[model samples]
Target: MENSLLVETISCTDGSLVGIATLNRPQALNSLDLEMTRILDKALKDWSQQPEVVAVIFRGAGEKAFCAGGDLHSLYDTMIEYKGQPASANEHANRFFAEEYELDYLIHTYPKPIICWGDGIVMGGGMGLMAGCSHRVVTETSRLAMPEINIGLFPDVGGSWLLSRSPGHTGLFLALTGALIGASDAIYCGFADHALARDQWEPLLQALQSTPWARTAEDFQKVTDLIHALPSIELQTGPLESHRALIDRICQEYDLERIGVSIAALSQNEDKWLSRAGQTYMNGCPGTARLSWELLRRARHMSLADIFRLEFGVAVECAAAGNFQEGIRAVLIDKDRQPKWEPATLEETAGDWMAPYFALSIDDPSHPLATLGR
Candidate 1:
């Protein structure tokens, strides 16, 4: 199908079928904007109802990235157009996040087996897309992260749901540090299913198309066997395994204050990875770190729809508070590596300060995402 936001093609081989969706914007690392989100959502919905499409595969056009993130520059420009008035831009941001969240939810509940070939940089919104697929294929070149903290935002796009469920304290560690995970590490953290060499992708695609589509499970197995037929490639070990002891020890503290103390302890540790993670956390937005800690903890028992709703609340509040603009200024616009975060120290960030962000006024059940229901 012809799409302005992406390229879509359906290729058939033998009795099997394949549906390919490629993010077409290589210049922006396939960053998703409102139009892109709409296009993706429409395509996925259509593919779900197509009888000929036995399996779907997602990828990016360039070698550089699967998707770097949402189109924050567009968001920044919109914010500017609204003159930074929170209420003026509130509806626009609300609609965007609602649509994006819906797209993520659709991916999570897709009927057919969806295989995402996350080959390169997959952060923020990209992670949301890939994490929900049935078969998440990563390559040695894959770099996955939920680095929303760097932009003074807590990880959204169902990050609270997925990251909270990661092994041990690994989720919290990644959320706070914005640390990048290679393919093997992604698999270890439950974010990716398999790690195949980048060169093996075409062969795997061919193998997928060669099988009979009538019996999906059997055909899936055939494709798996074909992929396994290739010689096994050595995977770079993840840092998680090596730093497990320290990560568990430091990340065990659920509250932000204790977590800061634990991070301080890591700064003094012998492990280099832990020390680096500590510094990253130290340099990150204290408010966001606290919010991340709270969001994950609270989202544990919440339904997916509820999670999105809660995130919508937080997102609007963040816009109102001016952190989003500052974050965009420092990270994207200024090209400056430094962000002068408010409440610069973790010690200054109190539980009560974050409480207001989480508070949804009972009278205002009018969230743009209020229509979202399980």
Candidate 2:
């Protein structure tokens, strides 16, 4: 139980090896649990320090999902206890977010290249893992999303930084609507680099291993060039490319009220996918949508380290506020598919109450993540 038999290493014929960390919970769709996060943090740290670890290949242990998301059921249970205790922010979600974000930041700044073979349902925490990797690969079957809005949580795990950097206002649409996208959509949004078919997984791994590697900056280039040289068919064109103009226009409206009105009207369009995305925004937790919007706005200039720090504070608060618990209950637990979100509508969701989540909660040098990116 302690070890994820799922997470292991792949040694190359050459002196170097690839650290292949698999999300092992296939039955749970390899959803990231606390144990998986902790194991990954330690494993990745070790891999990062090892000179022979040429790169790391991350994937999920399933035919279905790369990773569905976090272990929301566990998160919900812990959050309920946090509510019962009604204690300081430290007791709420600092442990999970701190470790998770630390791991994410490590991937972002890792000296060695990381290849995230992102396929199937890569959402929420899965997105965190894939976002920072040096080489992100997806297949036609890849169904990618943030989907935090559905569970009354904003996109954390450096979602702010990644989303903000995405082209145009597509990021805003995704954050609000939690729409699922495909290979090209991920590329268009800057979340992934390569799109290959499912059959190419083994061949790609072979390509990565057979390449003569050296421990130098040019070695990184070698890894990238090798990936490109692999036989890969073009991906199906994603919808984002066609909707770019309208998405940009809608996202350009900075005011939340105006954006809301515009998105609502856009839902009436003949395109069902775009219409569904709009409808999701209308039905999702208002608090989450509001928080996501503000986070993206402030995320533009944030350093990666700072973004993690900021996300920790905001995520911790969301835990204590009870919406995350209730939301997860509706979606993952009770499965009633109806969350009784407090301040049920955007107009009623208090900006004043949400304001605290945006503020810095920890700045001491001894903070767990203080040394991140150093």
Candidate 3:
């Protein structure tokens, strides 16, 4: 034990325990690597079975972020080592997505109340974890997004499901642009349940510890009520809220090409935020943009477990393909910020180009996460 996933228990007033999981990779913004994911999975599984454990709280170790995203540096290396192999032949990529998505799915259906201290940066995998929790607390410092477009990957970790259900077409706009949203925006988008000041974390924890738990179905509501009683910081309208009508209009069409054209035209918008979002969409990987759009549509009616299963295949495929590796090289390794995405343009990424990504990477019965929902 490296304590990368620090686990502890706080005794509640009624002698029950509140399990606390702190993601300890602050230097990396508490990014979830394979080891951390495994540790967290085991801890959560054990706690879910423990009679004395009434609830669980998940938080990151630093002031900067809860968890920025997944461990991309490691994924990049895996892609390089397994390059040219079949998607399923890249065992590390397959295992990583399988385990990570399983952990996320566990959180979604956990028996006890789960509170996410989403105080800072929450993106990608972090967003997945937070979305699954029964209660998610955002701070004034919180900034969130699914910036996977920047990395040549579509948002995985159950993001498609969450995005599919967001108000209007805001999710589609976010998927393409990778735009960052703050606390107010997070609550507005239903990604977060409550907002509190960053400094209120200590008070909230102390309140939780002193509470007399009922140890029944009402415990979830009890936790919610306590969080609601806490003081929240005043928030102004976020860019997403301000530009809602425009985003809805732009992404209303079901056709990806029409949506792309509408979003690309925002590059000249007077608001700097909208303009930058448009530029990001214009600069993002064409394949990723297409996947984001299509996945959201498909996930609209799919179960959470099914979405996880679908994302597992897509993630592995991206690793086997060159775009994800190229993205990691440019963004993280080489620091060049110029990924040479295959099929390079939005026009070239349309039609059945993404059909292969949607197919099963691993056979049904033998699939790593085949037992997910069952």
Candidate 4:
């Protein structure tokens, strides 16, 4: 109920059997800032301990988006604040990524049945929160992606853990191109659990809330049946679907150079969307793309805790590097839509450039989340 937090209410419907948490920042598309993350973390913990709260529902306030992303303006500002001092930037970066990762971990390991109503633009940090929920419900409006490459950062906030588990090379395709998936395609890629029409949300919530607390499983079944009754929203079709086969084939290459070559080949294709996505990748941060490839590849066998820890290290490295600030300047601050990346080609970003991300420093301790159980 705190006014500062993005979440609005913690109301119980169905006689306190279900708690509903609504993300209230409609104007900003319900972006999750640090304060909002702390608020959500606390709320989840609070409701999880309440015996009366049989289930919890997470949804955004407006129709535009479930959650767009984290408040990167704050992140950019923090980076700028420590522009002159490496120690200051590292200190701030560690705290930021650690808190964010901890919140993601909490969602992954929450005891209660946490249902997320992912209705619209769920990207980056939003995807992090949704991926960990017990039940992820997507609408036709849902447009999901891990677009950190666009911002000169590899997808963090547990992206390394979830994306690695996606089907075949689908995760790589998403990571490299920053492609957005609709509801059915999201379900196809294992990013979302249920695909329901937007209108069915209120009715579904009512049904979930009305279920008896003692017969939680039975009540959940009733709600599922109601959801099943809703009309099906068609999967992503046309050029997006046609391009998938080519994307899966081309992006399957482990080497970043081959991946770039494959993406460049798409430029000659007749498919406009693929061509645009190809161009986007061509123009995006080569260093970030390499980091993305490495992160997802390394994360394939890592535990969630380890993946988060590894990404924390990478994020700290990004803050130290100049790409994050330059990317933000071009894409967000300047709106010029052109980033002048250092060592602009994939060939320039060799193994040496990325070695520091994997190197452990004696000065820093292991992540506070090292204690996270599998």
Models ranked on lDDT:
3, 2, 1, 4
TM-score, cand. 3 vs. native: 0.98
User: Scored by Cα lDDT, where does model 1 land?
Assistant: 0.79
Which candidate number maximizes lDDT? 3
Model 3 CA lDDT for position 265 = 86
Stretches of candidate 4 exceeding 4 Å from the true structure: 1-14, 87-90, 215-226, 236-241, 361-365
Per-residue lDDT tens digits of candidate 1, residues 57-104? 889878999999888887776666665465426667777788999898
Estimated TM-score for each candidate: 0.91, 0.95, 0.98, 0.91
Each candidate: RMSD to true structure?
Answer: 2.6, 1.8, 1.3, 2.7
Q: Assess each prediction's global lDDT (C-alpha) against the native.
A: 0.79, 0.83, 0.90, 0.77
The list of candidate 2 runs beyond 4 A from truth reads 1-5, 84-92, 362-367
lDDT of 4 by residue, 1-374 (tens): 54434433343454666667777778878888777778888888887787777777788887799888877777787778777555335565667777888888988887777789999999988898899987889987889988877888888888888888877777887788787778877887788889888988877766665555553455455556656766756665534455667767887776779988888777676867677678778888998888989988889887887888788778877876778877887888898988998769889888698887766432245655566553
How far off is residue 148 in model 1, in Å?
1.4
In the predicted model 1, the residue pairs found to clash are none
Q: What is the C-alpha lDDT profile of model 3 across 296-368, one tens digit per residue?
A: 9989888888888888888899998888898889888999998899989888888788988978843378777
Which ranking of candidates, highest TM-score first? 3, 2, 1, 4
Count of backbone collisions in candidate 1: 0
Of 1 and 3, which scores higher on lDDT? 3
Residue 75 Cα positional deviation in candidate 3, in Å, after optimal superposition: 0.9
